[model samples]
Structure formats: structure tokens, C-alpha cells
Target: MKEAIMIDLDGFYLEPVLVSIGAYGITPIYEKPEPPESEEADEAPELPEPILIGYRVAVPVPSGLFKPRYDLTTWKAALSAYDDAMDAYCAALAAYDPDSEDEPSQPPLQVDLRAFWIEGLTRQEIDNIRNAPSPKTDQQEIARLEQQSTISMLAITELFEMMLPIIMPEE
Candidate 1:
């Protein structure tokens, strides 16, 4: 398996904003082997203790080589992974939709076809607003809010899926 993957970010970089992809390292934690079972004279054989293997797995990024590594199981590591992925995903979204009200604090980038998906959803929402009648009842309002939340959650899932390759360094 390859250790590091390089990526080009020449067009994606914006002034005062450094978004570079490089080699990410993944720390390996081996699973414990199950104990062996034996039956002889109604006695079980003793199993040897499991061994833990620790090694660094290098990951390829879009830009160049980066040295940051993380353990996936810990809370801190999980949060860091989330933050990094979200940062890149948000940047990509903002670069794609400069006029979006939910833009991140970053400069825009050149036209990227992948960034326009959220914009499509926005357009759909606009069309829905223009065509659908306003909800008059409280139950309808609650249902609308629930639907909005579900849509937002799905958007988040989409973003996460888009960044999964870069976020997850696991084999």
C-alpha cells in the first residue's frame, strides 16, 4: 500500500487562506487475536496473550506532503478529524458559492463543478418557496422545521461523503 499521496492546490488556494493537501499519517491499532480453544481430557488449553502492533500509515493528499497524524478511536482525534474535514468541505462549498449566505470565512476560488451541488439544492429550495403556499397552522410550521432539519442533515452527510476520501485515512 502507498504511504503518501500528493495533490495539487494551485487553483484552490486563496490569499490569507492556506489550503494544502499532503501526506496524512494514520496510526494503526491491531485487533486482539482471539484465544485458541482446545479440549483434551475436559481441559482447555491456555492461549497466548494477544500482541498489539503499532505502526504509522502514510496517507496521500491532494497538494503535497503533510505530516499530521491522528488516532481514530480517541475523542480528541475524532474531533480533530471532523474539524479538518469540515474546514476543507466548507472551503470548497464557499469557493463554489460565493453569494451563499452560509459562506465560510474564506476567499472564493475558481469554478469547480463539484462545488455547485449545494447551490442546486438552494435553487430547489427557492423554487419550493416560490411555488408552495405558506404554512398557516402551527403543526405545519413544525413539520416544515423538521423537514428543513432533515434536509440540512442530508446536506451535511453529502459534504461528509465528499470529503470522506481525504478525511478517512484508513485502509
Candidate 2:
């Protein structure tokens, strides 16, 4: 007896399977047929049954169905912006002076900074800056910049996560 199986091709396995389908634009589903029940089945020398292996259905998969949700251009830009922000923050840190009474200039941050802060300055570095007897204004400015740098880093991380499906599909 042959059974009809309906496969759902729209779930997590879609992209990787679709990619394997290639230019022919169709995916094939195959099933092994059940063997006939016979009293001599155990006594007869088993011959490989060709009929049990050949049944399959060609499933049409539209190329457009696999389009990526995230834009590659935007992902690259986010990474670049994060790199720039980190560079600026590092430059500002190297130039910092504990004795200077003047307000430390704010480092230029990329306009695209919008995300949760992940990691950046070490705890020791933050403690040294915040615990110092520097003016409240200077402490606040440095803290704000640090926050921006961390947030930018997190934004890039998020973009990469969003692009992972396209970059490395699960097998």
C-alpha cells in the first residue's frame, strides 16, 4: 500500500533545502515503500527491491520565497559605524587628562547609534573615571560617550544575529 504524505516546506528547514534544489526550482520528497508480507520472507535470499526506492514528488519552490529579511548593506553599515564609534572613544580615552579643569571634548559618535549596550570599558576603567574628583560635568560627558559606544557595539551584534540565517543556514 502506498501512502500520500503532505510535506510542509515553509518552516525552519526551508532555506537550506531550497538552496539544494538549484536551478531546476523543485524539491523532491522520497519515501521507501513497504515490503510485501509473505511466509517465505525469512527463508528467501533478500534481493534489493528497486520499486521500494523510486517513488518521489517534485515540489515546486519559488525562488522569491527564499528572500532574506535583513538587508546586507544595512548590516555592513552598522558594523562600520560601530568600529568608528569605538575608535573615537579610544582616541578620547588616550587623550584624557585627570588634572585638566577644562571640560573634555565629546567624541564624535555615529548618528546610527540605537541599541542596548553589551560590553565596552572594563569595570576598573569605569570605576577610575567615575570615582575621580573630576568635575561632575566631565564625569557625565564621559559616561554618556561610553554608553553610546557600548550601544553601538550591541547594534552591530544584533544586525549580525539577524543576518545569520542568510549567512549560515542550518543543514
| Cα TM-score per model | 0.21, 0.24
Q: Per-residue lDDT of 1-171 in model 2, one digit per residue for the tens?
A: 222212233211212322333232122344545555567756764544543222122233233322212222443577678788888888887898969986676665553312211223456866776688965698899999999999999999999999999999999
Candidate models: Cα lDDT each? 0.47, 0.49
Error of 2 at 105 (Å): 6.0
Runs in model 2 deviating more than 4 A are 1-68, 103-171
Q: Which ten residues in a row have the lowest lDDT in candidate 2?
A: 5-14
Tens-place lDDT digits, model 1, residues 37-123: 775758877777655454333432233212222222342345566677777877686577556677455533432222211121245
Q: Which candidate comes out best when scored by TM-score?
A: 2
